[model samples]
Target: MSTHSRTARSGDRAASALAYGVVGLGLAFLAIPLAITCLMALDARTFLGPLPPPALSLHWFERLASRADILSSLRTSLVLAVLTTILSVSIGTAAAVGLARGDFPGKATLTSAFLSPLIVPPVVIGFGLLLFLSKAGITNGMARLLLGHVIVTVPYCIRTSLASLLGADKRLTEAAMILGATERQAFWSITIPLMKTGIITGAIFAFAISMDDVSISLFLSDPSATTLPVTLVSNMRAAFDLTIAAAAVILMAVTVLLIVVLDRLVGFDNVVGQGLFRS
Candidate 1:
């Protein structure tokens, strides 16, 4: 090769190496803390510290399993997450369909209003819901939690569903209608099946958000209706121990499992990127 061409190729290789190095550093920054936390949870030590323990044991996991309060809180979180996923996906999909296909005044405004929960601070949303529920005489803790979670998770469902609908082939539904399918039939047979990936993506997002939420759950939860995250915070305040670490590891495992499932079913890149970019 000519000297100039060799120089250009060398510069490109160096640039590529630097880009790879940067990405590696970014991944390490995010992964190291999680790795440390998981390791500490396995440590035999009863206390939390920077240094690893002399040996590893399952004592913390045993303690976590024996904690009735934690188990109850976990059950509550699971129930709430499932309910939130169902409600948010159903309502948000309808709203998305209307927003994507309908020609109406204030369409933009309505879309913004539906997604406002995502942009608003969680603390503010929690406080507002607390006040509203109190004023409405809704004292049931589970009811309050369900309503709060649905409100927060709906935004994810709407955004994903809207993206899918907008990206879908408009002619598919029209062709079905021309072939003697009713509007409802076309929607069920053509539109919904095509948008399944987005809907599933939205459901997963809703489930994750509901399970991980603390601020809104804290506001809505009573002593009897505590969520896992709220219970974890309470335990942290009362005492710092390896039990919390073990619980953290368990939660992390659950999240990783969900992500793996999503990746297997629809691919993470497709769900995350396609939903946002397709819109």
Candidate 2:
């Protein structure tokens, strides 16, 4: 190779290394705060000291059991997350399949409209839905919360599902059809199996969003229908205490666990950065 070519390759290597270093640094920077928060949550008296107590103790975790309301809110949040995951995954997967691969009329415009929720601010969406629901005489309860979550989650679901759908082996469906399988049967047996990874990944996001929802839940939540994030917000606002730290730790753990599980099941790396119109 020429000397000029060698220098050019060396320069490219340096640039690539620098880019990777920057990315790694950014990830670690964002992770530190949560790491500290999780550590603090295990402390006996985290809120009393300088964020986390000097020493660690499982006192707060043990104390968590005594707070019945907190327990109830956790249960409620889990139920809500599951419901949101199921609904969002099912509908968004269907929508993604339709929009990404199908040749329907005005497909571009329809996809954009469907994905508008991700672009719009969450608080605005929450309040707008709040007013609309109130006007429609729909009581602000779990159903209201579910509706709001579904709106927010649909974009994620659709985007990821579309990614999987786009990467799918198109010939599988065609081959099935050629073998005398109907379109519906082909989709169910061939397309659906291939799309499972994306759907599960999207469902995980939907579940996490619903569980950790504060903006929508804040407006839509009633006393009985409060989600975990809503409960945490109420507690943080009304009283700053150690139990809140415990709750935060629990929430963070749940988030981490969900991510880990999704990665293991569908390969999280496969589903990330599929662009704005992903599964």
* Number of the top TM-score candidate: 1
Q: Model 2: per-residue lDDT, tens digit, 117-209?
A: 998999999999999999999995989988999999989998888878888768989999999999999989998888887788888889888
Best by lDDT: 1
* Model 1, position 225: C-alpha lDDT score: 92
Range of the 10 consecutive residues with the lowest summed lDDT in candidate 1 = 270-279
Distance from true position, residue 44, model 1, in Å?
A: 1.6
Report how far residue 189 has shifted in candidate 2, in Å: 0.8
User: Candidates' TM-scores?
Assistant: 0.92, 0.87
Error of 1 at 107 (Å): 0.3
Those runs of model 1 whose alpha carbons end farther than 4 Å from true positions after fitting are 1-18, 273-276
Deviating ranges (above 4 Å) for candidate 2: 1-25, 51-54, 273-279
